[model samples]
Target chain A: MMDILSEMLGYAFLVRALVVGALVSACAALLGVSLVLKRYSMIGDGLSHVGFGSLALATALHAAPLAVAIPVVIAAAFLLLRLSQSSKIKGDAAIALISTGSLAVGVVIISRTSGMNTDVCNYLFGSILAMNRIDVYLSVALAVTVLFLFILFYNKLFAITFDETFAKATGVKTGVYNMVVAFLTAITIVVGMRMMGAMLISSLIVFPALTSMRVFRKFKSVTVCSVFVSLACFFVGVVISYVYATPTGASIVIINIFAFLLFWLVRVLMTKRVAVKKPGLVLLMPLLLLAACGKSETAALPEGSAAQAAFVLEYPSQRGEAPAQAWLRQADTQGEADAATPVIEIKEKMFITQINDIYLNAGDYIGKTIKLEGIFRLEQYEGRQYRYVLRYGPGCCGNDGNAGFEVSWQPRTPAGAAPSQKAYPKQDDWVRALGTLQTYEEDGYPYVYLVLSSLSVLDTRGAEFVTQ
Target chain B: MEKDRPKDPQGIPSEPLILCKNLSLGYDGHIVLRDFDLRICAGDYCCVIGENGCGKTTLVRGLLGLISPIRGTIAFGAKIRRTEIGYLSQQEAAKQDFPAGVYEIVLSGGIGAMGLRPFYSRGEKQKAEAALMRLGMAGFRNRCFRELSGGQKRRVLIARALCAAKKLLVLDEPSAGLDPLAREEVYRLLKDVNRETGMTIVMISHDIAAVEKYATVVVTLGKEINAVGVGGEKK
Candidate 1:
C-alpha cells in the first residue's frame, strides 16, 4: 500500500491532481455555506451548465477554456440573479430555464464537432488524468484567494445571504456584494470544471454545506465545519479512487453523499435522544434539505464504471511509430524546422505533451539542447542532488490527478555538494534554464532528467500561473 | 384660520420628523395611492389604519425608503439617514426556515452600520447583546429563532430593529401570525418601548382596538392621508 502510494506520488500528474483537489474542494466548501444557506445552491448547478456551454464554444472557437468560460459563466450568473429577482419568474423556474438551456446548447455544440465522444463524457463526469501543470497552480492561487476574501468579508456576506433586505437597509450594498458572490462562484465553477466535470462539480459546492448545516445551526459553526468536512471528503474520495481505481469526480461526490447521510443520521439520533418535538421544526428540516437537494439532481448519479472507461478515454492512436503526429505537426507549424535552432520554443499549453514525448523518446535528442521556464525546486536523496523544473497544469478531472512532467535538473555547481548555489536559486524561484536531456537507469527503469549548462532567474514581471 | 392650521393642533412641535407631501406610491407604474400627505413627529407612536389594499403597507414602505414616490417628495429629518431608521418589514420577512440564532437576528440590525467593512465590529456585537437584554430576551440570545414562539420572534425582531434605529422604527403587520395572547403581548411591548424610550414608531395594523388604546397619533389611509387623529381623537 505504501509502495503504491509512493508510486502514485512519483507521477507529477497525481501530485498536481491532489493539490488542485484540495484547493478546489476548500473553495467549494467555503462558498457552499452561503450558497446553501441562502437557498442558492442550484446556482452552482446552473452556472456549471453555463460553463459547459462556454467551454464547448471555446473548444469550437479553438480558444482557451478557462479564459472563455470564466466571463461567460459570470454573465450567466448575473442573468440568473436578475431573472430570479424579477416578478416574471420565481427562483427555481429561472434556474431550471437557464440551466437546461445552457446544457442543451453545450450538448448541441459538442455533438456537432466532437460527435458526443469521451471528451463530452469527461466534461460531464470529470477525467482526472486530463489536467496539466498550469491548472494545479492556477487552482491553488485562486482557491487561496477565494478563501482569504471569503474570510475577510465573512460578516458582510453573512448579512447579505441571511437577510438581503435588512443588509441593504443597513447600507451593505447588497447588489454589489451579490454580484461579487456570483462572480467568485463563476470563477470557482470554471476552475473546478476540468476536475469535477460540469455535471458533478456543483456537488462539491452543495454537499459539504448541507451536511454541515445538519450538524450545526449557527452560521460560523456551519461554515467552519463545512470547510473541514469538504476537505476531508475530497481527500478521502481521491484516496478511494486511487486505491479502488474508481472515477475521481464521482468518488469525491460519493464520499460527500455518505457524509450527508451520516450527518442526517446523527442529527436524527440527537434529536430523538433529546426528544425536542418543537412544532414544524422537524418537518422543515427535510423541506430545507430537499430544496437544496433538487438542484443537485444532475450530478454523480450514473457515472461509475462507465465513468472510469471514459477516464482512460482518448481518440484512437493516430501514429504507430511516433504516436504524437498532432504534437509533431504543431512543432513543425511553430517554425521549428531548422535542426540546429538550439532552443525549441515550446508554447505554454503544448509543454506537457512535448515533455512527455521527449521523455519517452529520450534517444531522439540526446545531445541537443533546450530551454524552458518554470518554478524551480531542489530535493536531495542519498547525497545526490535532484533539482527539478516544475510546472502544473490541467490534468484529467481535478479529483486526484495533475498534468506536468518531472524534469530533473543537473545544477552547474551541484547545490548540495557546493552549498553556495543554494543562496542563488531556491524553491519557488521562477527561472529560465538552458539544458540538455539525459536518460539513465534507476531501479531497472529508464528515467529522464535534465543537465543545465546555463540558468538565470528572470525578472518576476508578466509571469502568469495559467498559460493561455 | 383654523383650516390653515398644521395637522397636529396639540402644539407638539409642529415640524415632522418625516413628511410625505402629495406622494404617489405604486408598483410598476400602477398607482395605489396618489396625492398622499402624512406627517410623523418625533417620539410619536403613529399607527397607520386602513382597509385591505388601501396602501397602508405602501405608505410604511415609502416612509422606510423601500419604495419610490411617483409624484411627490418624502423627506427625512436632519437627525436620520435612510439607513439609520430601523425597519421590521413583516412577520413573513424573516422566514421561519432561516437557520439563525436569536442573537444573530438581532446582530444583523447593526449590519447597516458596517457598510463595506467585511466583519462586524465588537461594538456591533455589544449593541446586539444590549438590544436582546433590552427586549428582556437576554437568556434567549443563543436560542434558535425558528424554534421561538411568534410573540418571542416579534420581540427579537423589534430588538433587532432597535439595534439599528437611531430615531425611528417602521413595522408592517408585526402581529399578523400571532394568537390573541401573543398579539396582546406584542402590542403591550410596543407601547412600553414607545412610552419609555421616546422612540418614534410607525406601525401598520388591522387591530383598531389596539390602535385606539395605544397610539399617540393615528392616520387613516384611503388613497391618501384621509384623517389625522391625536391621542385617539380627530384633530
Candidate 2:
C-alpha cells in the first residue's frame, strides 16, 4: 500500500488538488454550521445546481469555466436568497424552483451543443486533475477571502445563528450578515464545485457540520471538529479515489457519511453510559486516526520527486533505436494472436514496456488504435507546446523516462479547424485517451505521436513511476 | 407636559426610561397591538401580564426597537440607547438546536457593545462573568446549552440578558417552563437585581401572583394597556 501511495505522490497534480481541496472543505464546513442551523443547508444544494448550469454555459460558449461560472453562480445565489426570504416562495420551494430551472436550461444547451463532453463531465462529477492555473489561483484567493470574512464576522455569525431576534435587538445587523453568509457561501460553492462537482458539492458543506453536531455539543467544539472532519474526510477520500479509482467527489462524500455514522454511534453509546463527562476524548480518537492518514500522505509525498525528475529529464533526451523494429514487430504480433481488437487498451502492468516499444518502433504502431490512461501533460520546449499522455518509467537515471506518446486532437470535420486545448482536458488531468498511433517528422527527428479521437479524465490513479 | 406625569410611590425616580405613546406593533401590515400607551420609569420593576396572543412579546419587541411602531412613536430616555437594553426573546427553536456553551451564549450578549470590534474586549468578558455570577450560573459556564434542563436553560439565558443590561432589561417568558422553586428563585434574583442596581426591568409573565408579589408597577394588557403602581394611582 505504501509503495503504491509513494508512487502516486510523485505527480504534481495530486498535490495541488489536496491543498485546494483542504481549503475549500474547511470553508464549506464553517458556513455549513450556520446554514444548517438556519435551515439554509439546501441553499448550498441550490447554488451548486446553479454552478453546474453556469459551467455548462461556459462549456458551450468555450469560455473559462471558473471565470464564467463564478459570477453567474454568485448572482444566482443572491437571487435564491431573495426568493427564499420572500413569503410566497418560502424556503425549499424557492431552491427547487431555481435549481431545476437552471439545470433544465443547462441540459438543453448541452444537448444542442457539444453533447455531454469531457469538460461537462468534469463539472458534473469532480476532477481535481481538470483544474487549470486560473482554477487553482482563483480557488485559493476566494478560499482565503472566505476564511478571512468568516473570522471577521465569527461572533456576529454565531450570535445570529443562535438567536437572530436577540442579535437584531442587540444592534447586530442580522440582515447584512445574512447577506455576507450568502456571499461567502456562493464563493465556496463555485470554488468547491471544481473539486466536489456540481452534483455533489453541497455534500461538502452539509456532511461535516451534521457529523460534528452528533458528538460535540458546544458550538466552538462542533465548529473545530467540523473543520478537522472535513479536512480528514477529503484527505482520506482522495487517497481512496487514488487507490480504488472511484470518483473524487463521491469518495469524499462517502468518507463524510462514514464519519457521521461513527460519531452518531459514539454519541449513542456514551448516552447509554451516562458516566462519560467528556465525549470529546472518545470521539476525537477516531478523528485523529483520519487526520493521521493525511499526515502519512504528506510524509510520503516528497520521497518520489527525485525519481520523477530524473525520469522526466531522461525521456525527452534519449534517442529511440530505429533498426530494432523489423524482426521484433512480427514476433510481437505472433505472440498476441487474439489481440485483433480495434483499440488496444493498455493495462497498468503493461503500461511502461508497451509505450517504450511504441517509441522504439513507431512505424509498426502507425494506424493502430491505442487506448492509454495517464496524466495529460502540456510540455514547453524551445518555444513550442507539445501535448502528451505520460507516466514515469525506470530509465538509466532511476525512474527517469516518461512512458507515453504525444497526442493531437483530430478535427471534427474535413474543412473545420481542430478545437482549442481548452476544449480538451486541462493540464495534468488523469486522462483516458484513445488515439490512432502515428509518426511526425519534426526538425529532422522522427517522433511518435497519436491523433486523438476521444479524451476524458479518470478518477483512477495508477503507479506514477512504473518499472514494467 | 412633564409635570402631568404621575409620581412614583417609592420616589426612586420620576423620569421615564421608555415611553411609548399610542404604539401599534405587529409583523407585515397587520397590527397585533394598537393604540397602546405605556411608560416605564428608571429603577421600576415592571411586570406585564396578558393572555396568549395579546402581543406581550410584540410590545417587548417594540420597546427594544426591533419593530417599528405602525401608528405612534416610542421615545427612549436621554441616557438610554437600544444597544444598552438587554433583550431575552421567546425564540426557543434556534436556542434549543444551537450547539453553544452557557458561557459563550452569555458572552454573546456583549455583541451589541462590540461595535467594529471582531471580539469582546476584556471588560466585556468580565461583564459576562459578572452576569453569570449574579445569576448564580457561573458553575454552568462550560455546560452545553442543549444539555441543560428547561429551568437551568432559562436561568442561563437570563444571565446572558444581564450581560447587556446596562440600564434596562426586558425578558419575554423567562420563567415560563420553571417549577415553583425555580420560578421563585428567578423572581427573587430579579427583585434583588432591581433593588441593588436600580436597573429598570420589563418582564412578560403569565404569573399574576408572582407579578403582584415583586412588581413595583403592573401593566394589564387587554384591548388597551392599563397600568397601576403599588399603592399608587393608575398612571
Judged by DockQ cut-offs, is candidate 2 incorrect, acceptable, medium or high? medium
Summarize candidate 2's per-residue lDDT along A299-325 as a digit string, tens digits. Answer: 655443443455456434223432233
Q: Per-residue CA lDDT of candidate 1, range B30-110, in tens? A: 888888677787777888898988988877777766667888999887766776778787734454556677887788888
- The true-versus-predicted C-alpha distance at residue A306 of model 2, in Å, is 22
Model 2: number of clashes?
Answer: 4
Candidate 1 lDDT over A1-468, as tens digits, reads 344346456555567777877888888888898887777889999999999898888888878777789889989989887876778899789999999999999889977886665456667877564354455667778778887888877877877777777666655678787777887788888888877888999999999888877767677767877777787777667656654556778988998897789778868886778765342243344334433432342244233234334422432322343333343234334423443556743433334445554553456667667667666767678877656665654433342222233343333332333343223365765556565666666556656655555455543311223211
Which residue runs of candidate 2 sit more than 4 Å off their true CA positions? Answer: A1-5, A282-468, B1-15, B91-96, B231-234
Q: Model 1 Cα displacement at B173 (Å)? A: 3.3
At residue B47, candidate 1 shows an lDDT of 85
Candidate 2 chain A — worst ten consecutive residues by lDDT sum?
A317-326
- Model 1: residue B36 alpha-carbon error in angstroms: 0.6
